[model samples]
Target: MADSGQALARRLRQLRQQQWPDTTVRQPQLARALNVSVPLISSWENESTPKVPPVSRLQTYALIFCTRRSIDGDQLVPLDETELTTEESRLRDKLLHELLDLRTVALSRTPAPGSAPANPWQFDDGNRIVIVCARLPDELLTRMPYVRPEDPDYIELYTYADLDSLFELHGHIRAFNPGGEVRRRTAKELEPDDLTSHLVLLGGVDWNDLTSDVFQVLDLPVRQVNDWGGDEGPYFSHGDRRFSPQLADGRLREDVALFYRGPNPYNARRTLTICNGMYGRGTLGVVRALTDSNFRDRNTAWLHERFGAEEAYALLSKVRVVRGQVITPDWTLDGLRLVEWPD
Candidate 1:
């Protein structure tokens, strides 16, 4: 967020300086096209201390830069937006919209200086947080009913295997951290910027590649075994003991979940948290520990007390299911915590 202003300045300078190899657009030429003084243009381009230009000028800059006539001859020509062809209009709109977004961020980049607006899920810096979700395998999705376009139900999120966990975590994070930005991405669609911001990976190693990737680099004491179709079911292996789900009557009765928090290995300044379980119910259990209205306050407080300001910690807990509904696990309760870091 601190670089928002510099990003706007860099883009504007790139547009003016990179059009031609030998010649850069002089400030005077841009001033003539924008109908502004050269000194004002210089202020906008000054790298050491850049000034954000007005929106009207940004609109004209988009129009002129997208048009060939602006640089066809010897000078920058003023071109009206109405004169642009379809493709030119498309280009101009994209540039203008990007500039406007940058302007908004640069103008209000600084919020309260501390963690007043931040929750455990949100960052103190008020940066973006992306929740990466696991997508069902194509083979499984291809067989699920009601997913076909021709089907009457035609559920759009049928491909999402962890819908219950996604809905619970996404809404809960947004509600508690209203001042920060929150976004969602399927594992495959993760943007480059997402790796640098605060990230929350949902589901376990078998389905979520992001979770698998993080576990590979992070030095956590626990691991989620992903031996699908093996003799042993999925479980959380911590040191010497294996914590697997308890099944009765061919239905899950209790599940094992791992919740981890630490600074992101990719970007030390940002935080990385993973909520994973052997099954969806397990995932829901750990997420609701800090999001459930009845227990969130107590659960969150316990985490702060247990972990204190530690840079990293992992908690593996047992999630109980009562008549097919997942009951949120309280870390404070005895017998709920199976294993934990900093023990």
Candidate 2:
């Protein structure tokens, strides 16, 4: 009989094989995308009863595969709790509850500038919700078996940075008790704004130099931008950068900007510069560039080949100019609709 971990791995592998038959993905790459070590991925593929990736990691994966038209649009296939052995079910519930609690607490404390605050678990309903997070490569999302060729849901898939944004927003909402009630803000009320926003700096600082204020604001794991949402949440690197755009000579230049991927937020601003640039000229060139092999390969290479357009666009979309004077920063250049270039 297959153990639970084996069963889960087999199911996941089957789903990938069935959905992304032509795609070439490796264990190391998947491991990076999920922010776990390559050995862990190897264990999963080899049927070891590896610990489950955190809810946050799973959520990221679910979003990727679930949005594909092929997978029936269900990011997380609801498992039958009753079907699990009594002990297994209980353990699973326990883990889920722990994660939900951690997230709740993390989001409740008032964060100081550039830091994540302590988690607050003062709400009555904090125990009721189970939000599992996961991270998956864009290739997985695009190549999944049940996904559609052109799906809007897939287009809106979130990245580790985006998740960080949401996590920060959650913290802000928790601080305001927006409704003046304990932990009572709706999702809408948790939207990100300047006062409640955080800037994730990426490089050149010792982990020891990180301020409590930065930790409280981002609510991220110490020195890491990507973190899982469970008892055994794994930390992943989101290399130094954010997002930005530029326009010149009737061309739109898009970039995946960052500073550095490290354990400290103090250097986030230093490494934060436009890193990846996407250029577009005419409509045809822009469309082609969007799906160009060179562009995809180059961009994926920059991300250590663990992500694709799904993740790329998600990061690109979140870019907001915190403080700067740009001639054309709003996706348009001199009153012209900028086009997306290939590489």
Candidate 3:
């Protein structure tokens, strides 16, 4: 006989704002610690229309608020459950059960709408994912007959910036996410729905407009130091440290590639991932890093180990081109990382 939604909303708000007496746990700090967006936290605490967070997210809330240890530092870091003291563990259990009971009542009264989105690039939830690729430059398009509108035998394949990167990444993504629909589009061609769905951007800021657009919105310190991943310029930079391609004898020996995975700024329910490089080879290397048969498993395992359940992170690495072949980057190996987020 109670307004369960309002009760749940009030309790969730109390856990964040009221529970922390000495240290005020701000929404932004809590969101980062919980691996969600600032807006998402607001949604849950909204007075009028509160959205029920997922059970897993509720569990994170319990872990974080159970002990002040999680917010001991300037920023909220993850609290390991195993390290929780006796009192903290008991308190966490009490908080978790209280939230769970309210969540159950709220769900029965008004069921949460829509299918929950899976992790970025994971299609197990049967959601649509859009891969946005950069278009080839005008100079290069001039040489490809299919790209010319007036050409009699035009196929339009030349419109894509990096065919190798597209081909390798598209297939790999589709195969990995059999339950979902995976679609590819040029940066300039994304539909409105595509923008809200999981977005995978390939290539660099110079060519892909979406890549540049995304970088501007994210609060990351890393950025495109140089527009073009030319022979001498660094593709991305963090502070003063630059990640540039290594070249010798006018040949690209190693190229810099960035692999970024985070909550979509457009739609927090979905994810946004960027596999990019200064050159085509570097982009291809990033794609192959997680798709390569020999190394994909190891690289993926390392990713889970390094970041855990934290959804947002970035990796800058060296993409070595050996004898014209792109060598899959082994992320677990030493000295490969140029700059990694949340270090």
Candidate 4:
């Protein structure tokens, strides 16, 4: 059985690598996308870890590698299924069922965003929902999945968490109006007027320009931009305290994400939310922070009951991410403290 599982693991790894043959897909990247741990991804591909991923995750793998319709309506060649063998066909069917079965997904989908409790931050159909994503330079293309094909010069690759955040917010906005307009823009392209809309910045400063821009005004305890000589971050600084992706002993620290939700500095009438991290795992960690019920409730309650939007804007908070999820045993949104803004 283990040998068969190893064969299956190899096939899974092969299929995953085939999606971006020219690019290097690291285990941490896959883990961040699938909302699993790096060790799990390593184990799945290692074939000797004595552990196997669940069928639901295998379905996610298929979605990432097999499904392709183009998010931008650009036509692409479909995966050739006619040549699949009987076993291959059966496996494909199983993956699909695991992903689409209502009974399996009902519990997770039922809550939805923008429902009964109501979104306290003041969003309406009239206001546009702008999703700002980070655009990496051309030099980094070899490490990311291809997002936009037309832009051959700069391959705008977004982590699974970035796409996941976009869809999650889109769903929440669409719940208010099915025909609601949700626009996507890069941080580099953001303008003064764009800040007037309800905004969501997808990635942190390292990859997203918008997040970098927003951090300037908020002055959070953790910042992505700083003058640290030769070192670079999704870096965070609070007075004399500084934390980087590297630990004090020189070993790389586990990823951590900074989540901010409050008012937009450019326009007080609109709200701005940031789900970003120092790295891809940190980025996914921020996404998990926003989506997790415990964090969401505390944050939501704090937004609604503790203080107004602008006050919340002045303060910032952080959550530690171990794998791809937020560590929330003692996490509370109300626990966020104020960021001492310069006069």
Q: Cα RMSD to native, each candidate?
A: 21.4, 21.8, 13.6, 19.3
Which tens-of-lDDT digit does each residue in 8-72 have in candidate 2?
55644554455366553455545655677877666555555433443445433433333232222
lDDT of 1 by residue, 1-343 (tens): 3687788888888889885566688888888878889888888877667787766677788887776666856688866666889998898877776776666556556333441222366455778888888878989988789877798999767767678888988888787677889988888878889888899988998889989898899888998887768988777887889999999998989999989988888799888988898999998898888777666644554565567567788899999999999999967554799988978
List where candidate 1 sits over 4 angstroms from the true fold. 1-119, 145-156
Q: What is the TM-score of each candidate against the true structure?
A: 0.63, 0.21, 0.63, 0.49
Prediction-by-prediction clash tally: 0, 52, 0, 0
lDDT of model 1 at residue 123? 57
Q: Which is the better candidate, 1 or 4, if ranked by lDDT?
A: 1
Please identify which of the two predictions, 2 or 3, would achieve the higher TM-score against the true structure: 3
How far off is residue 95 in model 1, in Å? 60
Model 3: clashing residue pairs? none
lDDT of 3 by residue, 1-343 (tens): 2387778889988888888677678898888888889999999888688887766677788888888788766788757888999999899878876775576556556633542222234565578889899888788877766677787887766799878888887887787788789898998888989999988999888889999999899987587767444555665778887777877888999998989988989999888899988888999998888777666644664565567567799999999998878889977554687887778
What are the lDDT scores of the predictions, listed in order? 0.79, 0.31, 0.79, 0.54
The TM-score of candidate 3 is: 0.63
Model 3 ranges off by over 4 Å: 1-120, 227-232
Which regions in candidate 4 have their CA more than 4 angstroms from the true location?
Answer: 1-117, 120-122, 142-161, 176-179, 191-193, 218-222, 225-234, 245-253, 293-295, 303-305, 308-311, 314-318, 322-330, 333-343
Instruction: Report how far off residue 133 is in candidate 4 (Å).
Output: 0.7
Per-residue alpha-carbon lDDT of candidate 4 for residues 184-297, written as tens digits (9 for 90 to 100) = 777777776677887878876666766776778775656554443664544666676555654445433454455666677777877787766565555555554435543443
